[model samples]
Target: MSESILSISDNSEVILHFDLKLSDGSAVDSTRVNKKPAKMVMGDGSLTKNFEDCLRGLGAGDKKTFEISANEAFGMPNPDNIYHIDRSKFAADTELSDGMIMGFSQPDGSELPGIIRAVAGQSVTVDFNHPLAGQDVIFDVEIIEVR
Candidate 1:
């Protein structure tokens, strides 16, 4: 008797390698480049629903590519995530520059990463949106194991 293959489904533990790229074909991230494969559980809150949908029904050794929209990937940027803070809030020695990423503390003691959008003499504009927000992306995936 032949053994049945395990495919990705809800609650399945998956190990895979993936490369993320912008729609223009610029590389953004890659597990293969990092020399580590990514492992995750399906239906975990970590993955976007659309991204999980693309992984469904795939067995080990499956190789595929998927294109996801901005809304489906990192999501569209929310204007409310932008904040302007007084320059005095930062340490005097901290060099503020456009496109710098800084971690800010939240009331719950968690850290939120914010990107510096603008730095004025008295005010600094920070955007809390994910860096890839508002951009469509492509994902190249190789399923290594599913259990």
Candidate 2:
């Protein structure tokens, strides 16, 4: 008798390597580059439902590429996500430069990355939108295991 193969499903645990790229062919991220595979449980909220759907129905050793719209991948950027912070809030030793990314702690103690857009005398404009927001993504996946 032959053994049955395990296919990806909503209840399955999966280990895979993936690459994220932009429309310009720029590489955003890739586990294969790091030589580290990722593990996740389906419906575990680690990934967007739409993105997870792309992994469904695949078995171990399966490789595929998928594309998702900007909204589906990182969502559209919101103007409100940008803020103007007082330069005085930063420590004197801290460097403040336009186009530099810095972390700001929220009330919940979570850190959010903000990109500095402008640095006026007292007011510094920072954008909190994710860098990948409003950009479409190409995802390449290699399924190492599905159980």
Candidate 3:
């Protein structure tokens, strides 16, 4: 039987160090800061299909680096994601600081997370788009071990 390193077969565990960066070379996230490896099972939806596809055919102790565009990463931003709300919706104690994340509950009991983008008289603009939306990113992966 031929065995593969990062195959998504049953009973396989994958551990690796990952770094995410922008096209400008600015680091977005890296496992190096925490000095910890991220472990996951193959075929799990935790990672996007494009990312998982890159892990195929790798064995333990194997390391690889690849880059994915914004479409494959956080995806392109949608204009419909922007919304404006009345300032009264927020409490007086609420600090309307830009770049702050806040959660709003829908009538169906689902929660939507939005970032405070701007504040104006009696109105606040919130954006529910992903922070990295519309920007290309690079992902570096180092496969530590696979079982």
Candidate 4:
């Protein structure tokens, strides 16, 4: 008797290695290279609904490459997500530089990460957009297990 293909389903938990690259073929992220295969449960909201849709029919040992639009991946950058903070509010000893990502506490006590975009004399601009925002991405996934 032959075993079933063990396809993915809404009740499944999948373990896989995923590599993400830009349209230019420049790799943005890779679990294979990092040696960190990820575990994702369907309907858990860990992966976007569209991203999960791509994994829905694959079986264990399957490897496929697919393209994900920016909206389906990290999403488009929002100008409203950017904010300017007063340099004086930061610690005197704190080092602030452009392109630096730092965690900030919101008034609601939530921890939000913002990337430094500009450092003027007193105003520091921070962007909360995901680094991959507004980019078409390639996803190469190798399914290790689907249970």
In terms of TM-score, which candidate is strongest? 1
Error of 4 at 131 (Å): 1.6
- Model 1 has an lDDT value of 0.95
TM-score of 2: 0.92
lDDT of 2 by residue, 52-146 (tens): 99998999999999988999999999999999989889997888898899999999999999999999999999999998889999999999998
TM-scores of all candidate predictions against the true structure: 0.96, 0.92, 0.83, 0.92
Candidate 2 ranges beyond 4 A from true positions: none
lDDT string for model 4 (1-147, tens) is 998888988979999999989989999888888698999899998888888899999999999999999998889999999999999989999999999999999899999899999999999999999988899999999999988
Against the true structure, candidate 2 has what lDDT?
0.92
Comparing 3 with 4 on lDDT, the higher-scoring candidate is 4
What order do candidates take by lDDT, descending?
Answer: 1, 2, 4, 3
Of candidate 2, the 10-residue stretch with the lowest lDDT total is 2-11
For model 1, residues 25-111, the per-residue Cα lDDT tens digits are 999999999789999999888678899999999999999999999999999999999999999999999999999998999999999
- What 10-residue stretch in candidate 3 is worst by lDDT? 3-12
- Give residue 22's error in model 2 in angstroms: 0.5
RMSD of each: 0.9, 1.4, 2.8, 1.5
Task: Give the C-alpha miss distance for residue 45 in model 1, angstroms.
Answer: 2.5
Off by over 4 Å in 4: none
